[model samples]
Target: MSLRVLVVDDHPLYRDGLVTAIAAMPEIEVIGDAADGAAAVRAAKDLAPDVVVMDLHMPELNGIEATRQIVAERPATAVLVLTMLDGDDSVFAAMRAGARGYLLKGADRAEIRRALEAVAHGEVVFSSGIASRVLSFFAAGSAKSALSPFPSLTEREREILDLVARGLTNAAIAQRLVLSSKTVRNHVSNVFTKLQVAGRAEAVAQARDAGLGAP
Candidate 1:
């Protein structure tokens, strides 16, 4: 039997492209398309689709929250996140929200199809790079806390500081973490104080020396 599918993305052209591609696959059927997270949730409930190809950065509701609600409402349906944002926060948020699969926007037709099928079969899936990121996060989580720099800050502060060390502006960090610019600024200030740094340059230098952020 063909697997029922729902495609959800803010961009009309991209959603159309996905529909066209999936239509050619004999094993999958596009049951519906939604422009945003709210509409996606409504359609998913009404269609009872086997898989939801979800985009994370939506206006009304983000994909992570949508995935959590959809999975809560229907255990049989699978959420497959397709997004451009590959930041650690975005990936972990979706995973914590119960997404079964993740793929970058540039995924090929075959990989997309495979992800839908895998999630429909109740299996977890992720793009090759995303898989490695997830694994590395887990590995880092077990490190000794006492040996870490900036022990006074919370994990969120550390994450934000790491992004800062990577040379991301507060605005850029906000976009990466799906947070408002004001919140990012607050985090940045807190990070600076905790690390005893007087300015952005000093904080960044400290963070880099501690080996934070991506390589």
Candidate 2:
């Protein structure tokens, strides 16, 4: 099935350009476009697109807040943030806001297409630069317990944990393990509970320290 996409950005040219680019892809259909976060939310509700290309900055509602609202209201709709911001804070915030993809605005058309495809499939996709930041966060180690509750995690969860420690997004992990992004996300949540940790950092730390999910 062709993926229905909603392009959300404040800049008229950028929004139009992105929509045009994606619409040209045979696998995608640009069903809607919005100039701000509020518009994006309304369009999402009305159009129910399979994916949303969101911007970080916007008037009335920011991309992060918009993503949160959209995901909360429509869990099946994947939000892919296309922004110039490459900071770790932005990356993590978008992920926490339920973004399934985070790519730089400078990304090429092929990269953009791949990200949309990945997100549409329920995977989390991050640009290489953002991926590096995620990896750096993992390298810093966890502040929580040094050991993991190994037996508490299933085999699949363990595999997912390894990928998580390396800072691969849900989409990347799913692609690596040949599992659906939804399944990977479910496993990630399970890993958090098993490790008694709340966030990605702690989960990775516990998994690494216990030698439970290391590559």
Candidate 3:
């Protein structure tokens, strides 16, 4: 069977270019494209593609949350993160969220094709530079209880923090969660205090450092 694929990105030109390039691969089928993370999730559900080519910094849900949802709903569908971010936080967040492959935007056509094919076959793929980071992270043993990312956060606080990390403002989170604006504000405050961060920017930085998700 041809590899069914979905291309997701916020930029129209970039998304179009990606779809064209991927479609040129005779073994792959471009099932659809989405402009943002929420749309990507919805499309993935509706299309049931074999792979989702994802971009991280979208407006609504962001790629990490979308990937988490997709993998949860359809474990057989692989997520390949194609983003400009090479930082540890971005890299780790996507992997932790269940991405099967990670490639920098600068990757060549051959690399992109190979990564997609490998991921669709249940193999993990990463750009050469990113592979080293993954190895270094594991070799350092960064998986201990003492190294817990959000140590003092409550479940609710973590929920709020995740939304905030995804670029949702307090008002947006309130609307999405169907909570009062004041309630969201209070949760945000508590998250800051517990995380030892003074403000939103710091909170996002801390969350991203914990690989909570940044985009």
Candidate 4:
């Protein structure tokens, strides 16, 4: 049977091109496509495709959250992340959100097809570069843990937490990091969620205890 696939990306040209390419594959069917993450979620529910080719950054809802919701709603469905963002945070966040595979936007059609097939078969997949990073992270092991106590937090989140522990307000951190106040606030919220802290003070206390705010 042909694999049912849904292509999700905000870029019109790229999305169309991907759909065309996937449609040409012998055992894959491009069942549907969505321009953004919100539409992707709704389409996944309605179409019930075997695999979802997801893009990380999108309007309405980002791919990570969308992947999480889709996987939660339909455990049988698999999400294959296809995004330009290949940072550790993006990769680990997608994995944490239940994505079955990760591939950079630069991947060729053959690689994308292989990833979709692999994930549809209950296998985890990552591009060569991403796999190397994952392996290195595990290899570092305790050495990495000693440097950063919160393995769950992303690099940006850890940076924000360190500043918070040093008594920097959100505005200050935003200015220091050259990010918008809203973005900083969102990161802070994510940090609090990951740390399981109730509020800023609690997060600060935890960060300090972990030696994050050290000058």
Q: Each model's TM-score, in the order given?
A: 0.69, 0.66, 0.71, 0.72
Please tell me which predicted candidate would have the highest lDDT against the true structure: 4
Pairs in steric clash, model 2: 124-171
Global lDDT of each model? 0.84, 0.81, 0.86, 0.87
Candidate 4 global lDDT: 0.87
Give the count of colliding residue pairs in each prediction. 0, 1, 0, 0
Each model's RMSD to truth, in Å? Answer: 10.7, 14.7, 8.7, 8.4
Candidate 2 per-residue lDDT, tens place, 22-133, comes to 9999878999999888999999999999999999878777788899889999999999999987755466667767899999999999999999999988887999977876
Where model 2 places Cα greater than 4 Å from the true spot, the runs are: 143-215
Quote the lDDT for 32 in model 2.
90
Which pairs, if any, clash in model 1? none
Model 1 Cα lDDT, one tens digit per residue, 1-215: 99999999999999899999997897899999999989988999999999999998786866877898899999899999999977555666577678999999999999998898899998999999988866664588833442455555798998998888888998899999999999999989887766545799867755764567665
- Tens-digit lDDT string for candidate 3 (42-154): 99999999999999878777788889899999999999999997766567667778999999999988999999999999999999998986676568784542234553466
Our tally of clashes for model 4 stands at 0
- Give stretches of model 1 more than 4 Å off: 140-215
For candidate 2, the TM-score is: 0.66
